[model samples]
Target: MPKTAALCISVLGTGNIGSTFAFQLARTGQHDVTVIARPGSTRLQQLQRDNGITNHRGEHAELRVAASLDEQQPYDVVIVTVLAHQVAAVLPALQRSAAKCVLFMFNTFDPEQLQAAVGEERCAFGMPFVQAHVNEAGTLKATIGAGGQKSRLSQQRWVAMFKAAGLPAVFEPDMPLWLRCHSPLCVAFESASVLAVRRGGGASWQQAMRIARGVHECFVLIQGLGYRPYPSSKKWLAASPAWVLAFVLWLLSKNFTFRELLAGGVAECHALIGVMIAAALQTSVPVNVAAIQAMNPTA
Candidate 1:
């Protein structure tokens, strides 16, 4: 952990996921992690006062603070952990940044647009399977992934880097297709959780089955667009019995922690479903748009 040997990393966005990454990286003492919190915001001020980030476990991580990305600053890697909707706003700055690589870590369906903005060579895509949420107490509550799952990244170099930093990550060669395939499931579960939250607990049998149908139809829509369900899990999900998926979703909805993890995902769900719906119009395959819309949580 020599100062000269440490990687100079910058993370944009100080929300739950961003804070979690900054904390984890700084805690290793192997990276000089600096995170961007909005200038003049309470969040940035609080971090400055605390001198670091504190997780729910009461662990503290001392990291450098920044009001915004300094395009001239020399950074080894700049990590973007913002939501899908917020990414576009930061694209210009990220494009001009001196960082060698910009890792866009989040769920994104149209990664080509991002790559184009920053030059394909400078962009790295990843799907963070990390589950995280910030509570009213202002401490991040997070997990890399429950049940031994690792965050999936497109670059093998990033996979190895994250592993060395004490964060489990697996290299995925085809992240775009993997993310596209994952959309139906992501939207389904988030919508289901939103509905379940409104209904007290768990999606009803009818709603669960409806969500299952959306998954099946959405996968078909993906195929109609000429993309095979990229990963085998998605292939199986589309090909498997609807009742089985319904049962599993229903069971998970009843799990308090599982539902809570997705409860705050309304906006992300909306953006994802919007993409799916728009893509649906391009194909003749029929998607139960009304059903999917009903399952979707409005902004």
Candidate 2:
């Protein structure tokens, strides 16, 4: 009988999100993991010296650290979890690697460009269902998806491994659309929060609630466009009425950790909001376009 292949994996970034993913993967014991960061970078060094990483408050520890692709064998799955803009620079390196399966766990409106670059057979999209960020001490914190049936069987196996490790993992359908749906709303809320912070107008608590409401509005705009929001995450977020969403927002704001860690990126928040609004305006979704225009006369 032919031997089954082992899962060799590499994460292409070491930011807060990437670190959390790597830690989760290591804890799972499903794959041999490597973290790929910029050459001569200190993040990798700190990761190594941490004497194995831990998650869920040291509930699990996996003794692996960042390494270059050159030091390791070819990966079975190369997960590219870098910043959206950093994807292109890593493409050529990825193309040269021996990894057969490449998964992108990020937001990109243009999938065609990436597919063309990596070849369709080698690529998959990973849509993150929960939100998290680094605290003042730079610890990575995030929640995993609820695990739906959106991904293939093999993909489910990978997600299950993370779930075993204590990070929530789930499969879902239309992950890209799901990812996009959240981005717009997140961006909108970020916009309001940042604006308030800069103008010295709204309190942080008020801004957080407004942004949560804004996120709901983005989804409303999306449904207005006649495209059904990705089924699973939408169901979770949409389960709450506007009052609930607003209430949740207020609750999240009261927690200082949520605001300091997750709510500070004003520029990014604005760009995402702009994209969602522009997409609505340009598309055939009359209700979304009208809603956006109605809310923002500048549009």
Backbone clashes in each candidate structure, one number apiece? 0, 6
Model 2 ranges off by over 4 Å: 1-6, 27-30, 48-73, 108-113, 129-154, 164-166, 188-226, 232-247, 277-299
What is candidate 2's local distance difference test score?
Answer: 0.58
Looking at candidate 1, what is the lDDT of residue 127?
Answer: 80
Query: Which pairs of residues clash in candidate 2, taking residues 3 or more apart in a chain or in different chains?
Result: 147-170, 147-171, 148-171, 150-172, 150-173, 189-211
TM-score of each: 0.91, 0.67
Q: How many clashing residue pairs are found in candidate 1?
A: 0
How much RMSD separates candidate 1 from the native structure? 2.5
Q: Please give the range of 10 consecutive residues that has the lowest summed lDDT in model 2.
A: 290-299
- Candidate models: Cα lDDT each: 0.82, 0.58
Identify the runs in model 1 with alpha carbons over 4 angstroms from their true place: 1-5, 284-288
**Alpha-carbon lDDT of model 1:** 0.82
**Candidate 2 residues 148-191, lDDT tens each?**
41222126655665555445655655655666665654554444
